[model samples]
Target: MDEVVRRDVEHAHGDTRMISALAAPRRTSAGPAVLLLHDAFGLSDDMLRIAHDLARLGFPVLAADVWGDRTLPTTQEEIGPLIGSMVSNRSRWTARLDAALAAAADQPEVDPEQVVALGYCFGGSSALELLRTGGRLRGAVSIHGGLDLLEPDADWSAADPEAHVLVCTGADDPMATAEHRAALESGLRRAGVDWEIDLYSDTRHAFTSPHAKNSPTPDAVAYHPRSAARSWAATTRFLTELFPTVRPVEH
Candidate 1:
């Protein structure tokens, strides 16, 4: 994995400037691209490790960063303020996501027409928001991400009808409440998107992250080996369906 600079993304609500993730594919690709978004912890080591896993599966992956060059948040207590501010100011993340996709498409290793976005934890929510904001993806996969509406009452008519969506959720996640799931379901259904969901039983938030237990509430963020394995399989399956040419190397 190497740090290749992605173009500066435009973001600002009350003076926040453009931020770069210093992120790129863990390895240069000879196939399609996946734009990977990080969680509230920012582009931490765990997130980069996950990006590497995806890269090994035969895709050039661009790790997306919303917070511009700021110190990475450690504990949930430290993360709360940064994530809270970004969520409350939805424009910040939406713009950041857009720029990440644009940057991914521009990379020489990427097939501009074959780009998809994948997110983990907070990134999962951003992936969905990219759809809500009309991001033109071949497909999207959200692994244990929040389901709340980023912009309640926002129009969905502009969303890309060609993009299919896969949502992998921990059924018991407090962060992904019933209300948020309902809103996501209704919005996606109303938008006429082709989508699927893997509701992992007894799972909680950040099921794919070993570092999830580092959060203040361990149980709420505990990792589930079963769900993690299954969700990753689901993600690869979804990607295959969208791009039959997507050749995933043996794990």
Candidate 2:
């Protein structure tokens, strides 16, 4: 595995604040890059680990802190309200997400033209928002993220054809139910966007988070190792398809 170098940097869009973690393979030339968005709970250890893992795979990964410098929500009780606040102000949230993407693309070790936006849960929906809003991205990936379009009536006729999308989610995830998936698919299709969705059966919300197993709402959110591994493998494959010139580090 390649040694990963990482750092925290401040970023923002207007008044919305952000603290992003940037990670990349040491001693290697810059190749592709990914803008990683955290879940509703904020940028957790698991999120950082995934960023490093992707960095080791030869991509410069930037994990954006949507919550700014505020204390991260550690419990379900705290998480809902924090996420709700951000979601309520959809425009501001989207602008902050764009700022994160721009910051990642501006990194010295990132190939600006090959940058992609990726997110988990709340962040996942943000990735799709980038595409819906016509951000200049090679692709976008959503991991166990919400699928509903925040602004259902917003125009998507001008969506970029170059921006491919991949969504991985638990089949039984209450947050991303079958109805939600259908609605998202319909919207994407109507916009003529290139996209694919992978559903892991028997899995629920937060299936990719190791910490989910310890959550009080086990039935709604819990880690499933098999689903997590499968989703990750699919994500890498999706990335490879989009950025074929970028090679993974050999073990």
What would the TM-scores of all predictions be?
0.84, 0.92
Indicate which candidate wins on TM-score: 2
Please provide, for model 1 over 151-179, each residue's C-alpha lDDT reduced to its tens digit, 9 standing for 90 to 100: 55666776788778899988898878777
lDDT (Cα, tens digit) per residue for candidate 2, span 142-231: 898876535545566656876788999998888888888877777788887899999999998888876688878877888999998998
Clashing pairs in 1: none
**Which residue segments of model 2 deviate by more than 4 Å?**
27-29, 148-154
Highest lDDT model number: 2
lDDT of each: 0.74, 0.81
Clashes of 2: 0
Name the lDDT of candidate 2. Answer: 0.81
Count of residue pairs whose backbone atoms collide, per candidate: 0, 0
Q: Score candidate 1 by TM-score against the native.
A: 0.84
